[model samples]
Target: MGLEPDNMSGSSPEDIVNAVFGHFDPKNPLTFKDEQFNSDPILSEKALCLVYILGADTIQFTDDRLIEKLQTVRQRISEKEIPQVIVMTKVDEACSLVRNDLRKIYSSKKIKDKMQECSDLVGVPLSYIYPVKNYHEEIDTKNDIDVLVLRALTHIVKIANDKLLRSDFNKEQPLTYKDQHYSCDPELSDQSFCLVYVIDANIVQYTDDRLIDKLKILCQRKGKTDP
Candidate 1:
C-alpha cells in the first residue's frame, strides 16, 4: 500500500499503518484500491504475511513521521501475529564495497551493519532481515545481484509458507497418527497430541516433548523404530 505525501490532505502515519495491516477504512480519502481489503471479509482474512520493503540508504535518513508510521505498523503486525520480513533494497548504494562487488555482500561489514540497523528500526530480528541490491542502472542481469535477490525471495516464500502452515493448523481438524485422531485444542484432554512450533532462524522447531514421547510409544507398539 502506498501512503500520500506528508503534505497531502490525508497522510496520517496511523492511516498508513492501518492500510498495511488491512485495517484501513475504505471510505478514507487516502485509501487506495489495495488498501480497501478491509471492506471484504474474505480478502481481509487472506493476508497471511507482511513484507516491508525498505531502502538501505534512505532508512537512516527517514523522517520522524515516517518512523512513527513504521512503528505503528510493527505494532499491528505483532498484535496479529503475522510473520514479517524487511527487504533492505539498494544495498549497493548503501555500501561502497557492495557497489563495487555485489558478491561481497555477505562479507561486507558495512552491509551487515545496515541490515542490523534495519532490524533495529523495524523491530524485526536480524535473521529476518535481507539485504539486496536493486536493479537500478544495470542493463543486463548480474549473477551476484540475481543471487542476492533470489535469496531474499526464497526467505520471503519460506516465511509465507510457515504462516500458511500455522493458519492451516488453526483451521483444520487435528491430525491422525496410528489410527487415533487427536484434537488440537489446547484446553482439551487430547491437547497433548498437538504439536507446537517454535520458529527460529527460519526453522520450525517442535517443542512438545510429550507429543514426541507419545509418538515414540506408538512406534514401539507397532514394532518399529523411531525415525
Candidate 2:
C-alpha cells in the first residue's frame, strides 16, 4: 500500500504520527488491527518498507523541519526492523553532466554530492539511496533511465519480499497455541519437520515452562518426532 500526505513540507508531528501509527498513540509498536488504519484508506496495515521520494536538485532546498520530521519517522520505523530507501529523482536536472550524458550519472561529482547530502540529511545509508531522472518531459523512454529505475525497484522488491516471507513463516509456523490453555489435537494434520535436538544432561533441569514451551513450538515446526 502507498500513502502520500497532502503537504509533506508542512506536516506536523501529529500528521506524521497519524500517518504511521494510524492514530496519535499506538498501543503497540508496529502492531496494527484491521480497523486501526481506517483513517486512511491506503494504510490498511503496517508498512513493510518506507520509501522517501525526493528531488535531486531540491535536496538542499528542503526545509529543516521536514528533515527533522522524516528523521523521527525513520527512527520509529527502524525500531520494528523495517527497511527504508530513498529515491532521489530529477538527477538530470540537478547535474549538467548527467543531463547531457546519462552515463555520466555515477561519475558526476555534483550528483554524488547531492546523494551524499540526502543520505546525511535523511539518516539513510548511501547504498539504499537511488538517484534517477523522472520521465516527465521526455515523450519516449530512455534505456539509461529505465536501467536506473529498474535497479532501484529490484532491490526494493527483494527486501519487501524477504520481509513478507519471513512474516508469513513467523505467523503460521510458530505459536500454534493461542489461548491460556495449551492443548494438542491429534486429529489435526501434522506439519513436516527436518531436524531435532535432544536436551543434554546439564540443560535438562535448566529448561523451565517458558523455555519448554518455546522449544516445543520450535520442535513442532522443525522436527519429525514429538517433544
Candidate 3:
C-alpha cells in the first residue's frame, strides 16, 4: 500500500512503513530499491492498476529524441497494463529547462492523440493514462518523497477497502475489473517514472532523439506514426 526506499531484504510490516526513513535517512548510504511486488501470492495474481511515476535526483530530461523516448515509454506502459497514473514529477525541472517547450509538446490534445496512437499500436485503451506531482527539484526537499509515499498508501487503502466491502457482501466472486488478461481480483501496485529528456522554452530535445527519429521514420515507412 506504500512505496519507499527498500534494502531488498524482506522485513515486517512496520519495516515496510519505516523503510523510507532508512533509505532517505541522511546517515545511511545512497540507497536504491528495485520496483517490487508484495509476496502475497494471492494478492500478486490480482492485477492492480499501476502508478507510473517519474522522479527527480534520478531523472535527466533534456535534449534530442526525448519525445521519441517518451513515446517508447508510453508504449511500454500500454503494453504492460492500464496505468493508474503517469506521474511526471520534478516537473519544475522540466519546466525550467524549456519554459514553454514542455507545454507545447505536452498539450492536452497532443497527449491524447499520442496516447491514442500508442494504444492503437499496443492494442489498449488510451483512457488509463493519469498524471501526478511527485518530485522536489526547484524547491528541493524530501517533501516530494513524502507526497509519493502518502499517495501510494492512499491507493493501497482503497484496494483494501474494496476487499472489505466485498467481504461484507459475502459474494461468491468479489467485485473486480478486467483489462485484457488482467484480473483485478488480487490487488497489485506498480510504480514508474520518466528519465532524461531535456525541455527548454519552445524546444524539447530527446537524449535519444536521433535514434528515435530514425526508428520513427522506419515506423512511418511501415505506415505507422499517426500520432
Per-model TM-score versus the true fold: 0.66, 0.61, 0.27
Q: Tell me how far the alpha carbon of residue 186 in candidate 1 is from the true structure, in angstroms, after superposition.
A: 20
**Clash count list over all predictions:** 0, 0, 25
lDDT for 88 in candidate 2 is: 95
lDDT of 1 by residue, 1-227 (tens): 44333646445665655555555656754454654446544433455667878888887877766666677778877876788889999998888987888888889998888888888887989889888888877899988888888998998988877776675454345556542435444475633443454446543255478966766676565554223
TM-score of 2: 0.61
Candidate 1 TM-score versus the reference? 0.66
Ranking by TM-score: 1, 2, 3
Model 2 off-target regions past 4 Å? 1-44, 168-227
lDDT of 3 by residue, 75-179 (tens): 544443333344344433434432334433245453444444434432334443332334334475555455545665676557445644443342455444543
Question: How many Å off is the CA of 40 in candidate 3?
Answer: 9.2
* Candidate 2 residue lDDT tens string, 70-131: 78778887765678899999999999999999999999999989989989987899998999
- Error of model 1, residue 210, in angstroms: 15
- Candidate 1 stretches greater than 4 Å from native: 1-40, 43-45, 170-227
- lDDT per prediction? 0.72, 0.74, 0.40
